[model samples]
Target: MTDISTETRSVVIEREFPFPSEKIWRALTQPHLIQEWLMKSDFKPAVDHRFSFNADWGSVDCKVLEVEPNKTLSYSWDAYGLESIVTWTLTPTGTGTHLRM
Candidate 1:
């Protein structure tokens, strides 16, 4: 007999940037800016909008799940048989922004 576990885990990374949340939000939501940092994508910051990120290896299909202006963004990331949700949270800080992913 074989056993399978359905337990799920989360990995969180937090960073402080010396830029405002609005600026950080632009890098995350804007397709051109996103392409500069992440994969080439057709991402839009609107809920239910489907998009993809293309890379030399392959492509990742995703859909916007949530968006809250410069505060939060969540989406579904499906690739290589692994389906997951990626969320980004931006908090305004004294110096700049606190980003959580």
Candidate 2:
């Protein structure tokens, strides 16, 4: 069989929330808070801990790779046939939170 390889592209999603940086950071990092908006169920965060979410598209399993307080977070999105790193970075604005992916 011929060897085939694919290049992975990173996706960047930017959003501005009216909440403070700490609040936005908690929504992104804290499992319970995340579930309230983005997830269908509970999520746990620990090194190598797998978290599952049931969405309109389908079920997705992601493993926590790294976590940094109020700044950076990295996880492996393991669903379908695609495995990629998803990172979230939060920046504090004068009166709100700036989120970058």
Candidate 3:
């Protein structure tokens, strides 16, 4: 069981990575790398691509909304009786790239 709130709002998360955007992009779009951090499934970077993230408990059905190489990536996350859009923005900073989720 999980808490489900009626009110909806977008949650933003930001992190500063001490590496270039290409490296981070690979980790984000690559299925193997993503599975290492997120879940096990076939994930691609093509626009409108539908994929799933599978775990022991359940899975999430997602569709790619937007994809800009190493710049921005947006997708739909639906599961557990909830649906939300998750967008990741990578901005090049002075020393590294700033990743926002």
Candidate 4:
């Protein structure tokens, strides 16, 4: 048995990638690339386009909320009826793009 009360309150993940901002941006926004890295199931990028992610627990539905070019992306995590925000900040470095997630 698992203690649901002991579960973590919130999860925040931050990652940095050594790639150009444009490249990372595409991977985040583009549906095909997103399906490759993020989810194993089908995904579409239109606003209010409901999709499912077949996970070990169950399938979760999500809808796109907002998209800002190379900057910010937000969506609704329908499984929990919560709105989650994901932002990407791109800074040009001498060698490559400094991507902050």
Which of the numbered candidates is closest to the native, going by highest lDDT?
1
Sort by TM-score, top down from the best: 1, 3, 2, 4
RMSD of each: 0.9, 2.2, 3.2, 4.6
Could you tell me the lDDT of residue 74 within candidate 4? 60
lDDT score for residue 64 of model 1: 98
Q: Judged by lDDT against the true structure, how good is candidate 1?
A: 0.96
Off by over 4 Å in 4: 1-10, 80-92, 98-101
- lDDT per residue for candidate 4 within 1-101, as digits (tens), equals 96645333445555666777778778877767877776655555456666666667776677766666666666666566544444456665666566665
- Top TM-score hit: 1
Q: Can you give the TM-score per candidate against the true fold?
A: 0.96, 0.80, 0.91, 0.60
- Tens digits of lDDT, candidate 1, 65-86: 9999999999999999888999
Clashes of 4: 0
Instruction: Flag regions of model 3 displaced more than 4 Å.
Output: 1-6
Query: Which residue window of length 10 is worst by lDDT in model 3?
Result: 4-13
- The residue-by-residue lDDT of candidate 2 on 1-101, one tens digit each, is 98868976777999988888888777876767887888774565566777887778898888888877788888877788878888888888887888998
Q: Which is the winner by TM-score between candidate 3 and candidate 4?
A: 3
Which candidate, 1 or 2, has the higher TM-score? 1
How good is model 2 by TM-score?
0.80
Pairing residues by index, what is the TM-score of model 4? 0.60
